[model samples]
Target: MEIRVLGIGCARCNELEKRVKDALAELGIAANVEHVTDLKEIAALGVLMTPGLVIDGKVASQGKVPSKDELKKLLGGGK
Candidate 1:
């Protein structure tokens, strides 16, 4: 799966990326996690938030870092 973390390299953005990786690892799922720091790209996603999580090209969460449990749920829990 393509997991994109959109942010301008802030603390929250880094945290979100790490959490996403942990969640995917816990679920035994291999995913490509990318950090998008480009403003144009982030803006194209229509997110006005600094930290955004995009899973499979769809915006999953924005503005804050979600817990690993929440990320697992957002990823569909391997189902």
Candidate 2:
């Protein structure tokens, strides 16, 4: 599965990435988690806000960070 974290390298974005990683580890799921920092690319995804989460090319979360449990639920669907 592919998971992308969209942000301009902000603190919240970093935290969101970390939580995603942690969630994946705890769930024993292997996914390609990428950090997207380019504004143009992010905007192209219809994300006007930073710290967006994308799962398998689908926008999951926008403008805010998701908790570990939430991430687990989102990522767990990959199984």
> Which number leads on lDDT?
2
What is the per-residue lDDT of model 2 for residues 25-44, given as tens digits with 9 covering 90 to 100?
Answer: 99988889999998888999
Q: TM per model? A: 0.94, 0.95
lDDT of each: 0.89, 0.92
The residue pairs in collision within model 2 are none
Over 4-67, each residue of candidate 1 has an lDDT whose tens digit, in order, gives 9999989999999999899888888888899999999999999899899888878989998888
Query: Which pairs of residues collide in model 1?
Result: none
For model 2, the superposed segments whose C-alpha errors exceed 4 Å read none
In model 1, the Cα lDDT at residue 75 comes to: 84
Looking at model 2, residue 29 earns an lDDT score of: 87
Highest TM-score, which number?
2
